[model samples]
Target: MKILNFHIRGKMAHFRRYYSNSSALSYSVPPRTTLIGLIAGLLGFERDSYYGDFDPEGCRVAVGVCSPQKKLVQTLNLLMIKSSNDLNGSRQHHSQTPTELIIPANIRTGFLDYEVWICHQNNDLINTLHTRLEQKYGYLTQGVSAALGTAQHLGWAESARIVEGEEVAEAQADFFSILPVSNVISLHLSESRHRLRLQKEDMPIHFHPDRTIAGKGNFLINASAAPVNAKVKTAVRLSDERFITWMED
Candidate 1:
């Protein structure tokens, strides 16, 4: 998948890491953050596009998060399972209920070197996930607002473009947002799919060892999101030493 420079914008957030314009900026999250998906009944997002990373059983996917908080991560996993059940609880009248949360690893890294699983298959589940996130966490886009579109998500758009499997194409309605909290920050992206087609040559430009797991044929919409909800001023002035300390912990 080709990576395109992208951005997103919300009430008071924008992703600056990969954004190039004012209207588009979202959160800047570390790579491999856990992304959760609820298996709802209606069609959510396309499979190739939303699926982050799959497991041996093909029942779970990996998503990178900003930190390694066990309690925080487990809560999200459990919530996804419950939401998924609410969406597709009675499919074909299956009995053995699916495990609500699947912890792939006991100790995981925050973004920049970690991944979480998301079981997204339909829009209803996506909606449920969004609502749950918003409620549990006061805000989901803080880093973007604090960063003003110039942080970790520096090359996300370019990466996303490649995912479209196209080259030298034009897209409209691309936006970015940021969500920063304490020593952590997350980036969010939202844009129009119609304008993000790629050419053959552009596909080869986006190949990173860390990003290869997604592989080809996996075309996820450029809605890169994270859970950064740090306070404002403190987030913008995060010192390198402080940032490092946060990650190490």
Candidate 2:
């Protein structure tokens, strides 16, 4: 399999959970939909135009947390717009909303890092995407900028390149990326360097042009930014000897 690999580094990130009602809570890591949106933004894809193309049938994506992270809830002053005329806050109406933000665990000398791997069936599209990222990482120019959920927390792509990998039929192996529940047989949580906190989230799988989410799936992730030693059904072994489970898997 041919995959484009890169790391997104930022000072802060906030991926709002799908079911967050009043307060803006965030996911520990960016979900698959968020990953697709990031790639689309870099490629300058129009709003809601490329979701289908990045779906499971057209392309595959896998993301792994490369750094330890933590969440903080802050009260944000937001405009209380009652109508279109209130958009400018002319009425001096405002609301305090609790917003959750994610940052590096060791904020003193670390940044939020997410390793992204994407493989597309269309050769031309994949090649173009890789070129765009390569220019971004190499020349620090070309392509649009990347942001973590909010535009204020801007991010950049680094170490972007193409990689070659082959599918492995290993029944049980350690995986460095988030694993879809359907792809896992079981996890060996007993053997670990520290306490493990496994959490599952119901994330949107795909979005439609009509502004409605089409599919959703549950995924498991390690909150401590550590690889999960688990039994897996299938995976891709990259040339760097790293194993990853696809988001669609």
Instruction: Give the number of colliding residue pairs in candidate 2.
Output: 0
- Candidate 1 lDDT, 1-249, residue by residue in tens: 111112212111122223223223223232221121112111243333434322222322222332222111111111223446666544343333222221112334322222222332343443443443333333233232212122322211101111112212111212121211222222222323322211111011121324343321111212222232222222111111111111111
Residue ranges of candidate 2 with Cα displaced over 4 Å: 80-91, 136-144, 193-195
Clashing residue pairs in candidate 2, if any?
Answer: none
Q: What TM-score would every model get versus the actual structure?
A: 0.19, 0.90
lDDT of 2 at 51: 81
Summarize candidate 2's per-residue lDDT along 1-249 as a digit string, tens digits. Answer: 788898888999988887898999998778878888877766778878888788788888888888888888999888877789987778675778899999998889989999999899987877887777777434233355678887778887788888998887755666778888988888888765545668897787778877588877778887677888878888888989888898887
